[model samples]
Target: MQDTLILKGHILHTPSPTQLVAISHGYIVAVDGVVVYCGKTLPSSYEGLPVVDYGDQLIIPGFVDTHAHAPQYCNRGLGMDKELLPWLETYTFPEETKFNDPEYARLVYSAFVRDLWRHGTTRSILFGTIHKDSTVVLMKLLEEAGLSALVGKVNMDRNSPDFLIETTEQSLADTKAWLEASKSFGPLVKPIITPRFVPSCTSELMRGLGELAKEYDVPVQSHLSENYGEIEWVSALHPESDSYTDVYYEHQLMGQTPTVMAHCIHLSDEEMDRMEETQTMVSHCPYSNVNLSSGIAPIRKLLEHHIPVGLGSDISGGHAVSMAKVLMEAIGLSKMKWVEVDNQYAPLTLREAFYLATKGGGTFFGKVGSFEEGYELDALIIDDTSMFDANERSLEERLERWIYIGDDRHIMKRYVAGRLVEEPK
Candidate 1:
């Protein structure tokens, strides 16, 4: 069953971190939702194919959000003054507690899906609260909206407020049920194991969740060493473990499965070595770090170590939905790190940051976030006419300006898996 579509536009994509390939008046040929050709001229064999042409608009890969919280959508920009631990106590937990009502979950999850669509986030990895029913509501909404995401049902059985904590038995049972139910979703929406963090989940809960992850063969997502308070708390909680990363590894959470850990701002040298050895991915959350006064992640060092890296909104804690803005902030933060650390870390160029937002994060999703042949055709069509000046601009300049200043209004259309995604009803 082949369904072929052709689109003509000013094409741009990063085949590698340092390479930005641009083709003027390019043609993209996709068959069955995967790219087959992207170049300035179409092959003669396909000359008769009908083409949808956008005269002067820009075409680029859609953004991939590596970490975010669906339960925290309503809490965006509300608790910026508090650090990670207290923020969770005062604002995060209370708001997440509201998800006990499925109606409330529908209202917030629906709006959150629309926000992701509007911002051109074709794919994301998200955290849902511990309530199984409410998390399912989120998965259904994302599926309906034609977005792709790995949404987790959070598991935390200890050290949490009574209102939000689950007993260890109930936690495992609920998670197993949720994993089974997630089978109802389309290919785009799936489940991931989520333990809130080491401090919130007891060793028993983590072990059970790890075993479930292996049994189901699903990937995992969780918070890492994001702040000084969080790191110290993990140390105190798991005194027997060598470090925060070690606790998860000891519990069979990291090396045994594909895992993405958020906000690795303070990883030790040994932890870094272990992360590389285990092939774990780091979700670099720049805005959340700044908002919570968490220190900057040493992304350049991580890159040099050949560790995988990507950008995340970490919404509510991050306060933004747009990965374009997230990548911009990543570039800015890297500059600060360069100066403050005496040039130990060179600042990221725009191309490098763009790569992080796209293919870097997209790697977790398999062939997503690129315009290369065989890559999933997740794309954004940009109408940057409003930002244009009388003076001519190159494609790279236009893309840079859009990344810095463009919003949803400039996004004329979005596509996930080569299917046009309309705004959700």
Candidate 2:
């Protein structure tokens, strides 16, 4: 039962947020898609196995995108001038509404999966629209593509445009059916309960969805405190609640289930405490926050508080599929906050940003995002040598340049769960 692959290169990974484990002359051995050995030199116990020598290439764990809209991949870069609410109405919903057609879902989802792999994102948490058939298509495409992901069927019952709105009863029914039918899909591709956001869902709908989440024991993902208008709207709609985070806590949408909240930009001190206390994950979408003018998230503070933080390419709003781009943006945005907002917090380090892009986000999927033994071998091999001058560049500098400037052209090979994803010729 052991099919082994030995990759020799410059290995770089963060085993923990504060620790960077790099082996300049490293050898990683994966047996049946899981890393069994990773060290500076190959052990003699496995001397004769064929090795894939990446030479000077940099080997790192595949990126984990904690938030994305599968249906809105088509909307990237077209509606950058707008903010959250108007962006939703003008660009997002209209494109998502089109997913009611199964063929369109198949076409776009296939491309989205290809692009995700091309960009070194082997695992993700994705959003699909309310249409059940297309949601199934999206799941099938990701499953077929061998990507590890959680794709959700977004739920919205009230205040949405008529074209996209669903009755409270129908929304829950569809979500239940989707969860039940997910048994046949690949183990890596599963469902998450997605309620869109507080402004869009009725109180009754949220409670019912919460009940389903408990009944099915599934993880949940939704937007939280992204835009100023959205936050005020959540407060206005739920007056009894103290803050936007309190609304979800009141409705059983927070703390009880495994949760990932996107865009915690406008979080209050109390909300931040609540998130840390309850072990909630924050998906920092800096590009989307800047593009939508939704203020920068205090990620340094979040990490200081020891809250689980991860990077998300909130596609369309983010305008890029590459986690490499998002990683650089995260560092840049953190520096902006440090200088303009608070100097004591300091700018994010490349090591910390790398952790968020990989292991930090990969936490939701259990043992992923690193080369440590027993971790899933979800990884990428990059040839950024072309981007570097002939002068010797350290392993660290090459990675930095790749984060800020390199593209898919640098990704020579990709592996998800230890299996290579060969680009279609």
Candidate 3:
């Protein structure tokens, strides 16, 4: 018989908005990895199983970071004062160029995964450096760490520094190789197509990558309308197209598969309509927008239009790994948008913001980000005593406090696919 492990705690399942649920599970025979059994008394069948009781700890679904650059881990906080293009030229490109060395890739990638584990992000969508070797290094590290991730080998063929750019043929060949190499990566790690952005990729390269997406049926991720200058640059580069979003649409890259566009801050109504019709997800990286002077994403507008919006760290651009900080930044930036941009765009509440950090983003991966019955058992055991007073509080309050003030120190345990992989000291 497979080993059975029962976790008992105040479970905050993000099912039907925010509700507390009791969950129990064992290997293979779990309730689709979501602990289905909930009650004050254990079911008769669970009586003899080994139970790990977390008295008073808040058990919630593991955090899902919808967008991050794994290669930019070393460059976090380095180019804070510059706007998009200058920052790319002065700091971002130079830092990413260093990943050509396999040893450097291993060192940084290992540390990146460790930070994600420490911060309680068990599942992530990551952007790897353009170097194939380094991208592979990232995949191996995520696998070893037992993280569930969708990672991509970045594709850039034009408008970048010569050292960082690949020829159109070389870009397609390398990306195809990376896809083929990822076939055996197992469920925990999967490959996605990453076109650097509309400006860096020519029409030929973008169309070719779209073909590859069709061949492999993998997801595609890239930037869109992140900065005012970037939008103008895309317009200049693809004058034949109607708008920045139209460039991808013309190349057949949108709607055919799972697509995530980071930072849709300045999208037009037509772009929003297309995104909604195609079901493309937007990764709202608020900190990066504010830090780089990029515009705040109209998240309220996006959600109102039924666009799927999630959160991203956009490291080096935004400077942190903890999705906890991203949650705070998301709400903070929205309030700024309301104050400075439009009063009609009300600020996001704590529940809505936390939902974006968890279930809203986890939708990219089926059935994740909740402890409801039949969902995957990706979870975190958070110890919030540091902020808790002896005074009684509800489970929702504990979760709220943890999101606002907690760090890795508060993550008592982490589980993925019913397997206990990380335990706090």
lDDT of each: 0.94, 0.90, 0.85
lDDT at 260, model 2: 96
Model 2 backbone overlap count? 0
Instruction: At residue 1, give the lDDT of candidate 3.
Output: 50
Candidate 3: misplaced stretches above 4 Å? 1-4, 16-34, 38-41, 388-390, 423-425
The best candidate in terms of lDDT: 1
Backbone clashes per model, in order?
0, 0, 0
Q: What is the C-alpha RMSD of each candidate to the true structure, in Å?
A: 0.8, 1.2, 2.6
lDDT of 2 by residue, 62-118 (tens): 999999998999888987889889999999988898898999898898889889978
Worst 10 residues of 3 by lDDT: 20-29
Ranking by lDDT: 1, 2, 3
Task: Tell me the spans in candidate 2 whose CA falls farther than 4 Å from its real position.
Answer: none
TM-score of each: 0.99, 0.98, 0.94
Residues 269-345, model 1: lDDT tens digits: 99999889888999999999899999999999999888889899999889999999999999999999999874977
Write the residue-wise lDDT of candidate 3 on 1-425 in tens digits.
55555777777765633343444322212443555654456678767767788877777878888889988898898878899999989988888899999999988888889999999898999999789889988998888888899999998988899889999999999999999999979898999999999989989999999999999999889999999999999999989999988899889789988899999999999999999998999999988998899988999999999999889998879898889889888988899889998999888877778788888888898878875556777878888888857887777777777788878898988898777775321
